[model samples]
Target: MALHNKIGVLGEEIAVRYLKKEGYYIVERNYRNKFGEIDIIAAKESYTIFVEVKSRSSENYIELAQSLYHKQLHNIRQAAIFYFSEKNIHLSSIRFDLIALKIDPDAKKIDKLKHFTNIIN
Candidate 1:
């Protein structure tokens, strides 16, 4: 895998662990369709969430990560809509989430992590 892809995979794994620890039950990962790809799909309480994970080696990950997929959020949303239409899921609510991570390239550990909830709106 390329360096950025490796970073993304590692960041996504970390995001999954963080979500589980935060009481979200993982429904799926890497859900892709004609629209786009959603890095993680999870459920918590009454919400089914579509999450996008972004990773960077720099400490300025907040803006960088957020900007990286700002435009692609639409594609993720489209995929989520397609997903809901095809699945039997009946969550009371739906959400779009973002998990941004700054990883230590050498240690492969997170230097910073932020989870933005309901980001589309």
Candidate 2:
């Protein structure tokens, strides 16, 4: 894999570890549709979460933070809708989450990580 792809894989791994530690059951990873991609999908309580993860080693965290915008949000929502319909999942609630990560590539350590929940609704 390319360096950027490696960074994303590491980041997603970190995100999954954090979520599982926090009591969320992972439902899927790298869910894609015609709309967009959801990096992680998890279930907790009655909530089904669609997560978007932004990972980078060279870029500033703030810049990575700004990378997700309205278009992407819309696409994610559309994809989530498709997922629920396709999977026949009938959850009480649906939510969107953002997991931003900045890693030390050489050390394979995360320097900073933030999880923002209910990003869409």
Candidate 3:
């Protein structure tokens, strides 16, 4: 589709790979409900993590993790609750995480990646 959309898809792929490397068992991608979407849903240890992935061409402009605004967090939380209820999952702990991916044009890989955990209430 559009260039920006392509970049976003790439960034999401990179984020999933990175999470897998970190030993997270990915449960779903682009999990959505009426409220909004959660880019990734993963499990590690005893916790279920809802992830938001942000991608940018460069980190020089802005910190990608900062892009997750309060409204977005609210939507994610709503979606997470819906997902939990629908899946019949009674998790003892849940977490929200943001994964920022900085793309490298030359290498066709992520230039930088940052993970911010427990980002929402």
Candidate 4:
């Protein structure tokens, strides 16, 4: 795999761990539809969350969360809609979330992570 892909995989792993720790039940990972991809799908007490994960080795140059562009958000929304419809789920509430992971190469650990909920407008 390419270095970038490896980094991305690491970031996703970190995001999943964080979500599980936060009491979110992971329903899916890399869920895909014709519209686009949702990195993670999780559920809590009253909401189902569609998550987008951005991971980077460092945040000094650019923050990982900043990479979620408008078009990407649109795609994620479309995909989420499709997922719900196909599953025949009438959710009380649905939300979009972004999980940004900052990896520290030297320490071989995640330096930081931020979860932004209700990210879609």
Instruction: Give the candidate number with the greatest lDDT.
Output: 2
Q: lDDT by residue for model 1 over 14-46, one digit each (tens)?
A: 999999999999999999889988899999998
- Candidate 1, residue 74: Cα displacement in angstroms equals 1.4
What ordering of candidates by lDDT runs from best to worst? 2, 1, 3, 4
Model 2, residue 19: distance off in Å is 0.4
Clashes of 4: 0
Name the candidate that leads on TM-score: 2
Kindly report which residue stretches of model 1 are placed more than 4 angstroms away from their true locations once superposed: 68-70
Q: Which stretches of candidate 2 lie over 4 Å from their true place?
A: none
Model 4 ranges with Cα > 4 A deviation: 60-62
Q: For candidate 1, what is the lDDT?
A: 0.87
Q: Could you give candidate 4's per-residue lDDT for residues 18-107 as a string of tens digits?
A: 999999999999998899989999999999999998878867324556687889988998999999889898855889998877787656
**Distance from true location, Cα of 80 in model 4, Å:** 0.4
Superpose all Cα atoms of candidate 3 onto the true structure and report the RMSD in Å to 1 decimal: 1.6
Per-residue lDDT, model 2, residue 32, is 86
Clashes of each: 0, 0, 0, 0
**What's the distance in Å from true for residue 61, model 4?**
9.8
| Candidate 3 residue lDDT tens string, 13-97 | 9999999999999999998789998899999999999999888886732467667778888889999999989899785599999
Per-candidate TM-score against the hidden true structure: 0.91, 0.93, 0.92, 0.91
